[model samples]
Target chain A: MKRYGEFNALNGASFQTGEDARVVALLGPSGGGKSTLLRVLGGLLVPEEGSVLVNGVALPKDPEGALEALRQNGFVFQGYNLFPHLTALQNVTLPLMVVHGQSEQAAQQRGQELLTRLGLFDHLHKRPAELSGGQQQRAAIARALAPKPRLLLLDEPTSALDPVMTGEVLDVIRELAQEGQQIVLATHEISFARQVADWVVFLANGTVQESSTSVKFFYDPMSSLAKEYLTALTKYR
Target chain B: MPNSLTRRLIWTFVLIAGASLLLYATFASVHYPWNWSNAWSYRFQFLWGWGTTLAISLGASIVSILVGFGLMVGRRSPTTPLRLFCHGTVELLRGSPLLVQLLLGYYILANRLNINDPILVGMILLGFFEGAYLAEIFRGAVESIGASQREAAKAVGFNKVQMYRHVIIPQAIRRALPGTTGQLVSLIKDSSLLSVIGIEELVQKVRIMNSSSYTALEGYLPLAAAYLIVTLPLSWYASRLERRFAFET
Candidate 1:
């Protein structure tokens, strides 16, 4: 549970990932604590009451220990927060060299590879400002993947992109999912969630209203709150 | 582009030459009992004073920028007491007039601390005074960065030091540069305040020359011109920097 002064942002929101679920999606409305939950899972937020465990390792309270635990997760933010001062290549290679302590040559090679794979090889020397929204998000993904983190956490990755840009970014993520990368993304794109995610978690008012396989959750919701959410989501689709 | 810039430069130089000639003609023809020769004679002393001013400004600016960086870090620290201390320090220094701060440093603080070097004392006082303003520039620059960047840094598994060194400070410094240059120009002007403590800077030398020669037009005019010489190019370069770092979103 997490409290923002008097308001409870997360009220005993208990959830357990399936043993085989590689791509889990947190589906919900605005202010539903989906982003908060993703942050907690990524070890970015220390919940006031409950513990977060990733890959059987409990996230620690000490700052140093938290940094160590955070190494396992790579996050892609809604804004695609690429370092503005650095070129796309530098944005990807910086964390590898600085955080993971990779050699310059090694980091460069890895960054180049990832950027190329994301179809951004020509844009390597360009700064984030020079890239389109979709390209910037791809560079952000390359940056997140450079460290080879165990899990990827995406918080509303497509929220800032237009429909075309959204499709482009989602395609990159879908490719990663096909490659068997473990991911937990908070998204409002219900169709994308249904197509990409193996497990779906419906969150409303800081509580987990329903959790099930994506197929079941999409067609048959267990909770009335989940049903209402599905109805609203379907109306948009 | 080069040709146009060169033409502009030539025009600027022509304008300056014309202004100097006009000023010389005005003073030489209108003013009585004026010895332009006597004004030229004080060039050596004036040069020395200019050099002293430059040295003080350079030393003070370096110290000020470093102190400002430290204060920015302290202000952003997670610990409540440390953050409060940083805020209070910035507030206290900024709240007082720099002239009063200099007076205290030279008159009371220096004596209480038994500091003998007037130059060193001047640099420290000036640095601390300017640092308060620079701290605000740095703090504002850092704060202007999106919170998403900080979160991205943490998610990349960066410790605080690594995060700041690689991600935060570089961008902050870029954003702070134009403002910093402006402050440094202010520092250069403020360095004249050191004359109160008998530091033989530009203004002090001008004062001496005016007293001895009794030619306000001859002595003070060139003194003003000398300050312009130092500050004009700086202002130009700062604008260039503003354009250079103006990242388009």
Candidate 2:
């Protein structure tokens, strides 16, 4: 449980991903603890109680251990959170050289390759503010993927973008998913989640409402909250 | 139509002319004999004093920034005792008047320590007095960086020192520049207070000249101009730095 003052952001929330799951989509309404759970799972935030085990390794209670766990997973925030002072290439390369102990030449080569693959080749020298929302999010993804993290966690990566931009960013994530990169993303995009996710974890009121394979969760949701949520979300379409 | 440059020049000329007229009227009404020659004879003395003031300001500026950074770090330290000590020092320095601090620092503290140089005591006291204000400025600048940026740095595996060196300090410096420059300008003005300790800085020299020439206006006008010469360029350079570091949000 994580207490943010009087409000409980995550209260006794528990869920697990399948061993072979490639893309686990966390689905919930706004302020339903999806983001909190993702942060905790990535070890960016330590819970007030209980423990998180990533690949059978318990997330340590100490800050040093928590940081070590964080290093193994790449987290993409909803706002992109790109370093404004740095160019797109520099943002990715700086951490690689400084933290990961890569040489300048190697970091530059890897940074350029990742950015190019994300279709940001022409805008490599542009700062975060100079790029569109979609482009910034794509650059953030590239930065996260630069260190070859064991697992990637995204917290509503496209929520701040318009529909057109959202589609473009989602396309990039779909490609990564197809490439067999393990990813866990919290998202409001119902159709994209159904299409891309192998596992689904539906949360509401700071607890998991349903946890199952994407097929079972989407087609035959057992919980009333999950069924109601799906109907409410799909009704607009 | 006049472009911005032409308009700016016209306004500048008008303002200067207006200021000249105001000064002329004020001086003409005084009906006192205007004799700049008496003060002018001490040109060498004025020059020496100006140099001393410049040196003191420069030294104090460096010392204040270093001490301020150290105090800011201490204030943010995890240890309770160090944090409280730093907090108490900042409060004590900021609460008391600079004049009292300088007098007491020199008479009581320096006297006991067997430090004879008034100039050295003045510089140290002035630097520490300004450092308290600078510590707050630096702390605010560092805190203004968003939580997400720190998180991003951590997720990328940057340890505490690496995060500060690579990410936090670079951004914090940009935010701190304007305030720091303002503090430096204040530091320069505050150096005048060192005149009380017989440092023979610009103000002290002007006072000595005023006493000999018995001409307050003639002695002090050039003194005011000298201060503006130093401060105006500093402010302009600070604005240039602000523009250079500016980036779109």
For candidate 2, the lDDT comes to 0.92
- TM-score per model over all chains: 0.92, 0.95
Scored by TM-score, the top model is: 2
Cα deviation at B31, candidate 2, in Å, is: 2.7
Can you write out model 1's per-residue Cα lDDT over B4-41, one digit (the tens) per residue? Answer: 98999999999989998997798679755767788888
The residue-by-residue lDDT of candidate 2 on A70-188, one tens digit each, is 88888899999999999999999998888788999999999999999999999999999999999999999999999998889999999999999999999999999999899999999
Tens digits of per-residue lDDT, candidate 1, A1-237, equal 978899999997888878899999998889999989998888888888988866676789778777777887799999888888889999998888888889999999999999999999899999998999999999999998888878999999999999999998999999999999999999988889999999998899999888889999988889998888778878855
Q: What share of the true interface contacts does candidate 2 keep?
A: 0.85
In angstroms, give how far residue B241 of model 2 lies from its true place.
0.9
Q: Candidate 1 docking category? A: medium
